[model samples]
Structure formats: structure tokens, C-alpha cells
Target: MSEKNRQGKRTARERLAEEREKQKSAEKRRRVLIVGASVVCVLGLAAVIGVVAANVGKDDGSESAGPVVVPSGAKGKDSLAIPVGKESAKSTLTVWEDFRCPACKAFETAYRPVIHELTNSGQLKVDYHLATIIDGNMGGTGSRTAANAAACAQDAGKFTAYHDVLFDNQPEETDDAFAENSKVIELAAKVDGLDTPAFRTCVEKGTHNSWVDKSAAAFRNGGFTGTPTVILDGKNIYQDQTMTPAKLKQLVQEAAKG
Candidate 1:
């Protein structure tokens, strides 16, 4: 078998143990696992390139379906409800990611328009599943820190806002940590009526940590070992450099038609 297939044969526990040897914490290991998984990943679907939307929370005025329901207690967004399309949308595209990852940053930037096109036009719905499985020390805290800030952002219903800011000002994980660093507090400050104090305190104490950490654990359990891992209507979309906006849109549209 090929190297990818060779690696794929290992169970999550086996891969996780190996990843832990490389990273450390189960959280970080999980992030590493995801990155590893995304490289080859449980494969399926087409590849596209482009920008997508990043909104927060639920909207009452919009027609079609309701809000995206998060199983582990839905969180908040910085600005508006995460810019989702139809709540009851037949086609749901969910992303399991770590904010600190560089690849995820690229994917988010590329996915913006695609998500907008699909959701805004009411053809699809998307929800973000935070996994701070990786640490900043690797490529940056794009994994953990971003996930934490996202949780705080979600608390204030500013997840999408914080998400954009996090990507816009992504710092070097090795040089500066965003996950447990002061930047998270600063980001929390930017959101109006966001209970910054509570968010800061919560993050510091890890009050809402379970959501991010547990999700990372779930990612591990779900057979997804990576950041920016996209699940399209229960199907895994595995693409490395090829996972562009056009590709995501194509899969979503094709899935919708099916």
C-alpha cells in the first residue's frame, strides 16, 4: 500500500499516541492528528478555490431553516449570527478547525465568498466546530489560542468577528501566543457589550474550555485528526492544497443536488 494508505490503517488511538509523542497534550496531539488527517484524510468530494462567509449566531428575519444547532451547547458570535444560509438547509457543510493553523487561515480566506454564495443565496448552511487541538508553538497558536478566543467570541456572539480578526492579525505562534496570551483579552475588548471581563476571566480560568478541548477530543474520536477539516453532509472532504473555495462550493452544490 501507499504511504497515505499505510498511515490510514492505524486506529485513532494508535495515531493519537504517536501524535502525542510529537505534541504533548491530548489537545495539541488532537490538533496534530487533524493536520495529519487533513493531509490525506478520509477522502471524498471535489476541490475548489475562493472566499467564504464567517457569521455568528441565529437570525430570525431570514427565511428558510432556523439557526445551525451546535450539539455541545451553541456558542456566540462577535457581530451577527455566524453568516449561515438556511437553518433547515438540506445541505449542511460543517468545518472542524483550529484557529491558529496557517492552512486554516488560508482556507478561511479562500472560503469566504463560497460560504457567502452558498448561505446568502439560501442554498447551504455552514457551522464552525472549534478544535484547539494544536498549540501556538508549532506553526502558531492558530490551533489552541484561536479556538479559545473563538469560544470567548462565541460567548459574546462575536465568533465570526473574532475569527476574522484572529486571521487578519495572525501572529507567529512560536513568537507570541494568542490562545492563552494577552491578545485574547484584547480581542475580547474589541467586542461591544461582550462581557470582556467575564470572557477574560473565563479564558484565564478555562471556564468555557470544555467546548474547545472536548471538541478536539471529539475530532480525534470522529476519525478526523486535522485543522480545517470539512465535513459535508456527513461526508468528509479531504483535500490538502487543493481545498479551495471553488472546490468547497462545487461539493456543496453537488451534495445539494443529490
Candidate 2:
């Protein structure tokens, strides 16, 4: 081969190697940039989550900071449960409920009759724990206010009747009607002897607001996902799709026999 041709071939091979090295460098830089951007995105998301968590903590603290005026004759841990039947009843139904929750209202509507019958017959007792989750989610005080009024009724020795009246006249979840003390007092007129001055004062002043907040905190801390969490004799009957008022009555009757 001619010397000039050999020299030209060597130069061409050197140029090709240089070109490949440039491409490799460019690819490495591109990968680094992509990783950096991904890290930045992750950090940004974490910061946002932190801010949201802090805000939630602050709100919860503010809501829960007050005197917890438990209702008269309240039962259970922290006196957060309103009892509705003879203590000697064979079965106890634990109900975690929210006043402004539509599902809770539905459950009450469907089960109220059977529950009343069972309680009246001294076969079953119910421990009602009130939560204000709807107030937290929907941005209102109706749930807490209504709960306070119910507590006042408990003090008046008319909790069951007032509770039924409240459920029967529950406003829409989005409607803050129950937030108005007058509205709750108006509903109290439906319950005999529940519209007295002390009841009105308790309702207006939100005497049990802190207690209600504590109950809501308990509902959340208990790992419950939603309202109307109905547990019959330690079994969560509400989670069973086949559960009905008749089934509930049958369960209570069986418990009574045992």
C-alpha cells in the first residue's frame, strides 16, 4: 500500500474513535441531568406533603384544645359514649357516627326501629360515639354543634328522644343548618321537654364541643375509615353487605339467649 493511503486510513480511524467518545460523554451528562431532575421532583413533593401534614396537625390541635365537658351519664373511655339501654342488656352495640354524614343518617333510618325495640325490651344496649368528621371534611361546624346539643339533651335525661329527633331532622351534609344553635333548638321542640333553658344554653354555648372533638379524634385514632361504624358484640356488622335490621335483631336475640 502507498504511504499516503496508509496515513489517510489511520487518520480516519482516529476521527471515528473521537466521535464515539463524544457520544458517550453526551449520554452520561444526559443521564445525570435526568437523575437530578427526578431527585428535585421528589424533594418538592415531600416538601408539599410536609406542609400539608403540619397544617392538619395545627387544625387538629386547635379543635381539640378546650375543656372536655362530658355529658351526664356518659359511658366508655373518656366518657365519650352516650348510652341507650339497660346496662344489664345481653348485647352491646358500639356505634361510631357523625351527625352530618349522610351514610350515618341512612344507617340510623334503617336501623332505628329495630334498635328502639331491642333497647326497649332490655335485650341490647347501644353506646353511641359521636364524631365530627363531616365537619372536618365538608368545612362546617354542624356535626360538632349537633353533637353538643345531643349532649345537652343527655343532661336533660332525654338523650334518646332528642337523638332520634336530630337524626329525623338532619340537614344535608353540605348544608350547615345544624351549625345554627337556633336550628338545633328548633329541632329540640320535636322532643318532649328537651327545649328547656339549660338545653338551649348548652346548645348555644357548645358545652360539649371539646368532648365531641375528642370523640372524633378517637374515631380517627381507632383506625376507622368512615362514619356509621357499627359493631355488635365486638363484630363489625356494618361491614357485612348482607346485614339488615332484621339480621341485627336476630343477632341481638341470639346474644341474649347465650
Candidate 3:
């Protein structure tokens, strides 16, 4: 073979090797960019979740008297419960719930009427503790916002009606739709004479946000986990897996008999 032909072949091999190395380098850079972008996106989402969880329960440091959703017939003005029936009732029923929780909606649907009947008949008075556990778990402000709106409704003396309506119109657990102020106002209309401008302004300004935070804090401090937590005579009977609304009413009646 001629020397010139051998030289040309060597140069050709060198060029092909250089081209392959260039291609490999480009692919490596592309892979690195893709992985880096994915990691950044994940970190950003996590940061947002943390911020929302922290801010949802923030104390705004206002000394304003909290929402007055307690019924005219209720007792204990200083506590978190909006009482129904006489304070002299034989039984006290405490319920802890998050408006955004599906399980709570199920519990509400099953037990609301029974509870109403008992309260109306003067057999029991209920203490409602609103919680924002779903907000912490799901990483959004929907639960907190909804709780705040309910507090505002409490100021209108429509806590029970607005409370029931909130559960009735509860969005899917994963959705943050309740975080919108308008939605709560819309739900307030379901309660007769509840959608007043004062209620609207209170909800829009998050006037009860701090109170909602306090209530949520009480729930956490109460050492109970999860929503739809029901306590009858200071006992956690709803923890039983088989307990139903009918069973709950019977238990309340039985407790009253004691």
C-alpha cells in the first residue's frame, strides 16, 4: 500500500473517533440537564408544601374576639365548641373534624341528624373542635381556609348550618378548591341569612384565620390523630372500627342513662 493512502486512512480513523466522543459528550450533557431539572422541580414543590403547612396555622397576633358561631342557647363562650342544647344536658359530645376530609364528610352525613335530634331533645350538648390535619398531610391551605370560613359563619350565628353545608359541598380531598374565598361565601348562601356582607368581608379578610389556627392547635394538643374523631363523655368511642351513626346515638343514649 502507498504511504499517502496509509496516512489518509489514519486521519479518517482519528476523525471518526473524535466525532463519536463529541456525540457522547453531548448526550451526557443532555442527561445531566434532564436529571438536574427534575430534581429542581421536586425540590420546588416540596418547598411550597412546607411553606403552606407552616403558614396555614400561623398566628396573626390579633386580640380580636373570635367568631361567634355559637348558638344563642350554647354554653362555654371561652372554648372551641359551638354548643347545642342546654349546658345542663346529661352528655357532652365532642367532635374533631376537617372540612376537607372525606372520612369526616361520611361521618357527618351519617350522624348529623341523630346528633341534631339528641341536642334538640336536650339529651346532649356538642363541642365541635375544628382541625386542619388534612392541610398538613395534603400540603395545601384548603383545610385551613375552609375552617376559617366556618369560623366567620360562626360569627353570623350560623355555624351549624354553614358547617353542614361545607360538608355537603365538600370537594374531593385532593382538590384545593375550598381555598378560594368565593367558594365559602357561596356555601354560606345555603344557610338562610348567613351570606351577609360582614360574613363576606370576614371570610375574604381571613379574620378568623388566627382562631382557626388556635382550634387546629387544640386538636393537635388534644393528642388525637386524624379527622372525624368523636368523643362521647370524654371517651374516644369512634375509634372503634365498627361504630356507626346509629350505634353512636345508642351509645349517647346509654351514656345519658348512666
Candidate 4:
């Protein structure tokens, strides 16, 4: 073949190879773009699902469907509170907590002694409000079931004992172990006279589920946003950044003085 023809053929072959390489690179770029968009869309959908699941039991001004069985000493607008101090006490400390909340467990473990001292000394009256926001966020019946069992303990006149045990034995945040009625009853056995057949029946049948629902509703409607929400003399101490367990005592004493 002529040298000119040979050179032209070689150049054409090289050009063809370059064209194929460019096409492959363009196809690879298109695939990458498609994969990235798909990933973003999937993440967006997952985020939406998470938000919806977290708000499943949120209070929307709607009442509970079941009958709300308020405990004997329950107080509050919807009768969903358990009071733990003398009526004549000057300081009112309101606590909103969820049994499944790790933060609530931390607060309870850290401040239980001071809380007991104040309540025992009649220097403070604490109103305990149970919330099940964990159940809403984590997708389990454990929060509701545990709250109902606590109410049942109140019926048996053992709220404080059972309440202490519940926090002491709080499972991992995502663990739905508390959802089992048998497990709740077993925990009740830790509190004297709290494991009675009546209490068992109350928990097994979820007699106070409505009250738990109402408590959650009251929590949301009370303009609170999270667990371990501590309020003293109508002031939200949890909102204060410098407030510690010691500061809590001072705040309560000051409130009592007023």
C-alpha cells in the first residue's frame, strides 16, 4: 500500500479509537449522574418517612379514641398527672418525661435524690407528667404500655416505687422490650404490692392507655417540645443553660420563698 494511504488508515483508526473512548466517558458520566439522582431521591423519601413516623402520635387537638381511665390521685385538666407532694407545699415542680427517653433517664438518675428530699421535706410539690414521644419517634408500643403500667401502679398506690424501678431498668432507646406486657409486669414485681392481679389486669388490658394518650396530648398542648422538660414555679428550668442539679435546688428554694 502507498505510504500516504497507510498513514491515512492509521490516523482514521486512531480517530475511531478516540471517538469510542469519548462515547464511553460520556456514558459513564450519564450513569454516574443517574445514580446520584436516584440516591438523592431515595434519601428524600426516607427522610419524609422518618418525619411522618416520628409524628405518628402527635397531639393535633384531637382526643383519644379509647376511654381515659384516670388514676385515683391524678390531677390536671385532663386528669393525667400524678402528684408527689403535699398540697400545701409552696413550690410546684412539674416534670414531663418519657420512660424510653435516654435523656429522661439521665435526669431522673442524676436528680432523683434532690427531688426526693424536696418532696419529702414538703419544700416542693412535683407533678409528674408521663409522655410517650419515644413511641412516636421510635415506632413501638413500649412507651404507651409502660406509661399505662405506671398508671396501674398508681392505682395500686405504688407510683413512686414503680416509677423509680422503671427508670432504673430503662432499656435501650430503640429497644421495644417494654412493649411486652409480661415484661412490664415483671418489672412491677420490683415494687411491693405493685404486682397484684389488679395491676396485672390493668396493664394487660391497657386500661390506662387512653390516659397515656391524654398525657401526651397535654404535653404537646402545654407548649413543650422535648423530654426531661423541667419547670419550677411555672418557669422552665430545662430551658436555662446554666441550670444544674445544684442550681435546680437553689431555683426551687427561691421559688418556695416567693
Candidate 5:
């Protein structure tokens, strides 16, 4: 065959090799984009949240009883105690998660039914420590914005619902991830007793900005270097490659058995 004719066809193995190379390149670019976006989001908005929070002097309507002290189980670890769910369970489960983290989303979805069963039966209470892990993964303010929005829903006792919506309607991580205003409203509307005027006011001026920053500070100060970290009944569990949610639930159950 002529040189040009010979080049016209390739074996299946050769084609497969080419496709694998393309996939590897795509994964590399994706990793870089996620890191760059997260840094920009945190550096820009975290500062803004600090400034806004300082100006409020505690009038932001998110006043908790006092500064949450890390429990003995999660001692020397990074964590926060936000009363998520019904706040009335034999044992409490605290999670530090980024709204935009896919693993976080998966856990949220996977554990929903169990949570409902636990909360309804008064077996478990869950607290979410919202961390901005994705600000470094996705290149935008989506993580920060989503964190603040969660706080806003939290005010109305609707965080669980809003939490689900955020992960459900999540856009691909990019500069545009945080620009969709309508999605915020859609999530907010689902929150029961979420006053439109008050919620709108909070969202408009980003009232919940402080909560996001404060949570991030807690994560850093508490020594957590990653998102989706859990403090179950006071023991910190930094998941390794072998970790699974079933094992986590087993841990929770065992802790509660005591």
C-alpha cells in the first residue's frame, strides 16, 4: 500500500489507545480548572463575607446561642455544630461538606432516607458544618454562594430541603456556576415558611456570607484539610480509599449503642 493509503485505517487496539490518551488529557484539564476556580472563589468572597459580617454586629438573624465548642469526640479537629434536621436525636451526626463537592452530594442523596428514618424515629440528629471545599475545585463563587444560601434556608428551618436542591440542580463547575439567579429562588421557594421579603433581602445583599466564612475558619482552625469529613458522636473520621457510607452508618449506630 502507498504511505497515505496505509494511514487510512487502524486496528481496534490502536483506536482504543488513542481514545485513552484523549480521556487522560481531559481529566488533567478538569483537575486544573477545579483548583483554579476554588481559589478564586474563596479569596474573593471569603474576604467580602468577613467585611459584611463585621458590619452587621450580630443583627444578621443567624444568631446561635453561643460559639460552638468542639466536642470531646471531635477534639483537636476542625468541625462546627449547626443544628441540622430536627435537633432531637439520641446521637448527633456532624458533617463538614462543600455544597459543590460531588462526593458530598452523593452522601447527601444516599443518606437521605436513612436520615429521615432516624430523625422521625428520634434515633439520629444531624448537624452540617458547611465548608467551602469546592471554591478550590470549581472556578466560581458557587460554593460560597451556596453556603450562604444554606444559611438563609437555615434561618427558616429549611436547610435540608435547600441542601437537596443545590446538589440536584448543580451546574458544571466553571465561572458561570454561580451566575444563575433563578435556581436560588427555586430552592428558596421550596423552604417552608421562608418569608419571601426576608429571604429575598438576605439573598440580595448576601446576608449569609458570614456563616460561610465562619464555617471555613472553623474547618481550618480545627485541622480538617478536606471536605466531607465527619465527626460522629465526637470521633473524627477522615475517610480513606476504603471508606464507604455503609461503614459510616455502622459507626454511627455503634456509637449510638453506647
Candidate 6:
């Protein structure tokens, strides 16, 4: 090969290597920039989450620290249960529920008719213990707030109707609509004579917040796993996959016969 051609070839190889090195450097810089941006975004999201968590914690602390005020006609230990039937009924259903819990709403929707029938017929009584587990799990005060409002309804002698209203109008699990007292009071309008000034004051003041908190503590301490912990005559009937509203009515009827 000619010397000039050889020299030209060597120079060309050097230029090619330099070009490849520049491309690699550019790619490395680009990757670093992308990683840095991703980290920044992650940190920003974490900060926002932290703020939200802190705010929720503060709200929970303030609301749950009040004096325990039991609603009128509340029964059971420490007045934690809101009874929804005649005390003389043969079958008693003990229900632990959270208003914001979708499963609890589902249970209420499915069994409401049967329960109302049994209660009205004086064949069965239900002791509803409200819990705020959804608030603890989902990071909001909707569960606690709604439970307080229900307690206020109990004070107004309209618990069952107001309770049904709450379940009927339950928002999405993640939606904290019930955390606002106004929203809760708005729902009370659906129940006859439940939107009085006394009820509104009780709800707005969170009069039963401490009671609801205590009930939630009881639920947690009772070794229960989830909401809608339905117990019929000391049996956790809710765990029975074969259980249905008709089956529940049958069981209650059998208990009444016994």
C-alpha cells in the first residue's frame, strides 16, 4: 500500500474511535440526567405523601381525643352498641362495622331487608358496634366522622334509618367525603326528623368521636380481622361462605323457635 494511503487509513481509524467515544459520553450523560430527574420526581412524590399523612394524623388525633359521649339508648359494654330491635328478641346479631368499608356496605345492602324484617317482627335484635378501621388503613377520617354522625342519629332516635342512609350513600373507599361534617349532615336529611339542630350539633361537634374511637379499639382488641364481623348467637356466621340472607333468616328463625 502507498504510505499516504496507509497514513490516511490510520487517521480515519482515529477519527472513528473519537466519534464512538463522544457518542458513549453523550449516552452516559443522558442516562445520568434521566436518573437524576426520576429521583427528583420520586422525592417530590414522597414529600407530598408525607405531608398528606401528617395532616391525616393530626386530624385523627384531634377528633379521637374528645370525651366519650354515648348516644341515647345505646346498649352493651360501655354503651358501644347501638341496638336496632326489641330487647326481648330471641336471636341477637352482633355486628362490627365501618361506614366507609365497602364490604360493610355490601353486607348491609344484601342483608338489610332481612335484618329489618327480623327486627321489626321482634324475632331478632342487632347490636351494631361501629369501627373506624378504614380510617386507619386508608388514612382518612371518613370512617370515624360517619360513625359519629350515626351516633348523633341514634341520639335523635333515628339510627337505623340514618344508618341505612349512610350505607346507601357511601362514597368510594378512597374518597373522604364523609370526613366533612356538612356531608354527614347532608345525608341525615334523608332520614325523617334526623336533621334537627341537636343532631346537627352533635355531628358537627363530633360528640361521639371518642366513643367511636373506643369501639374501634375494642374491635382491634377483640382479635377480629376485618369489618362486618357478623356474629349470630355467638357464631361468626359471616365467615361461612354458604351463608346468605335467606340462610341467615332461616338461622334466626330456628333460633327463635328454640
The whole-model lDDT of each prediction reads: 0.57, 0.81, 0.74, 0.80, 0.60, 0.82
lDDT per residue as tens, model 4, 46-107:
34324433554563333465777898799977777799988888888889988887767767
Model 4's alpha-carbon lDDT is 0.80
TM-score of 2: 0.76
| Shift of residue 215 alpha carbon in model 1, Å | 0.9
lDDT per residue as tens, model 5, 99-176: 766556555555566666666666677777776645644345677677767777766567677777787776654444
Q: Give candidate 1's error at residue 31 in angstroms.
A: 36
Best by lDDT: 6
**How well does each candidate superpose onto the true structure, as a TM-score?**
0.58, 0.76, 0.69, 0.74, 0.61, 0.76
Candidate 1, residues 57-170, lDDT tens digits: the string is 110111212332232236334211233457767787778665655556666665666777888777798777765544522433335555655766676666666777777776
User: Which portions of model 6 show Cα errors greater than 4 Å?
Assistant: 1-63
Query: lDDT order of candidates, best first?
Result: 6, 2, 4, 3, 5, 1
List clashing residue pairs in candidate 2.
Answer: none
Kindly report which residue stretches of model 4 are placed more than 4 angstroms away from their true locations once superposed. Answer: 1-65
- Cα RMSD of predicted structure 6: 13.7
Q: How close is candidate 5 to the true structure, as a TM-score?
A: 0.61
Worst 10 residues of 2 by lDDT: 51-60
Better by TM-score, candidate 6 or 3:
6
Score candidate 6 by TM-score against the native: 0.76
lDDT of 6 at 257: 89
Model 3, 79-183: lDDT tens digits are: 567665668778998888888877677667767889999898878888887788777766578887888788777777788888899999999877988999988
